[model samples]
Target: MTTPSARVVLKPKRARPLFAGHPWVFAQSIARVEGSPEPGDEVEVVSHEGATVGRGLFNPSSAIRARLYRWDGGPLDDAFWKARLETAVQLRRDVLGLDARNSAYRLVFSEGDGLSGLTVDRYGSCLVALFSSLALHRRRDAILDALRELTGAEGIIARPDRAVAKEEGLDVGDVRIVGTIPEDLTVFENGLSYKVDVLQGQKTGFYCDQRENREAVARYCLGKRVLDLFCFTGGFALNAAKAGAASVRAVDSSAPALATARENARINEVANVEFEQGDVPKILERLKAAGERFDVVICDPPKYAGHARDLAPALGAYARLNHAAVDVLSPGGILATCSCSGLVDRATFRDVLANVAEHSRRPVQILEQRGQGPDHPVSAPCPETDYLKCLIARVG
Candidate 1:
């Protein structure tokens, strides 16, 4: 093992999180740097007592000053990356049975796979890699090489999260293609096929994190009228239709997404689903005013809160969105509501649901609570990895 050129020393007694296996070393915890290290450089992290804690990527510009990748002192090389990627893929295949029903699944879930800020999703033969940190972005070549060698994927693409890049003080360009990226890529989830525009799709072309939740929501849709809010590409709507929904109305503000949803519905030969393009909140109010009611309503909105400061407003927005969804639900209807905000804990989300039920004048019975699919595993020490929350309740 080679000695790291840079070293980060933590403040007095501030290495508790690192010792506890939490990967992030916040700017506040860092006391000083012993060597000159640029952003995206590997650095040794040590406690105030001068005991080595771990080796991590240093980013002085980010609030997360350092993100530990290895607790044991070792060099990060081709072999290391290959082992990490292989281990992540093996877990998905063995534990999640990812290849059995779905061609699209999260192969690596950032910190969950011991690789912070690097997410790789497989869309059939294509692999979409998202680098959220400057450190990972800088090592894209090595990572992509390992991915190609391990997965034997036909095409690999890089879609750096613009928000994350901006936060990390990195100026990243447009999406870069590494191999022969097919113009139209289709992936299967729960035995349902949907076309993926991997080159220009949302979050690696599809939201594979909600794969199991979508399937689970289908169980209650049999012979029921369903409403899928923010139904991007019709994952839940199609699943519900496949489960024998009487009628499924999928609503989203994005015309392109709705078009894709319609295409997916046609491809699946599911005629019960109707795609609508409009503001979801306004459309919900319109549906309520028109006396339209659904037996099963799903509200899976995007992340409302990204940081601590946005928590208050996000709670309010979630409450309003859920209230609107509940207002259009028939008595004894099922509501599958979700929040993908990491800042909002399960308790806070449940509280928001309760407040929505109260405001909507509907009493709710909790039926089931769900998180992201098993493929998107969460690390015990990193709470950020546990983001998605879905609550299924019966309202009357």
Candidate 2:
């Protein structure tokens, strides 16, 4: 018998999701490997019936055996990659008009932008590109070239996703810098200025995903005392303070992030925001004891669940923090809570909030449910891209 070459054959009935346009192919669903394929190599995916499903980057180290990029069985060459990159850029620039309003925004949202495992956020003239896949990381040079040409960026910084290094078998060492990067990079969002440290700051120097949410949540902050927990770089706090909030108190564990937030406040002349650095749970406990209350509270914490196994504990932690938030919330107060973990779906997080309502015995009325902004577009076929869950509710 002749060899079928390097390809991944799916088990019976496992091709449904791939056929449905889902990008990831789990190892468990794979029936067999027809040929030996190196990591980050282009390989075809086939069903048990010998029908060609698609072709994508094959990674044996990660649980996701393959991340298919094309459904029409196209080649993933440099031109193909550049076309995908251009499409992502066009969405932010032409479709969303993100650049016309804000200099800092998500340019490419990994799987959300059809480029699985790669995300590029523009921080003013400096562009920060994060590589989550070995295949994408290998093609950083070509990708950065396309990005620089498309955006006319002054500098490009290629950073590794250290969180996924172990799982994805990545080498997390140093960041590759191209072109000239300003020592002090600042970005504007919703009429607020923030100093971004692309080399040292959190998640590409800023959390641009919450840009719209900050503006939306601040509307309720006017003439109300607002508390922002896990307020990294004071995104929600500054917005609330600027929106005429009575006073804003923000808490975070990272001293560097708080320092940046304080600096942002200083530069923007926003003096109403007071930043406290400490563990959030302990701070929440202290606030409850102090009998402090706020009319509007924003809880935007870091990712609690990194994997499926951590989902239970993440839920427990969320329930604890939210219950504590409810403790400090006044009757009929607004609570803007958020979860960044993709594993914690909207339904599951809602279930947690339901439990919180039952335990605290408070009437929970959901005002609006939001997700990552349009810049972080969600692929309908890939629900995993829709990771963020923001719930603005009234707690009694």
Highest-scoring model, TM-score: 2
- For model 1, the stretches where C-alpha displacement exceeds 4 angstroms are none
Encode model 1's per-residue lDDT on 15-109: one tens digit a residue. 98787788999998989999999999989999999999999998989999999988889976668878988999899888877787679999999
Q: Which pairs clash in the backbone of model 1?
A: none
Each candidate's clash count: 0, 0
After the best TM-score superposition of candidate 2, give how far the Cα of residue 357 lies from its true spot, in angstroms: 1.5
TM-score per candidate: 0.97, 0.98
CA shift of 165, model 1, Å? 1.4
Model 2: clashing residue pairs?
Answer: none
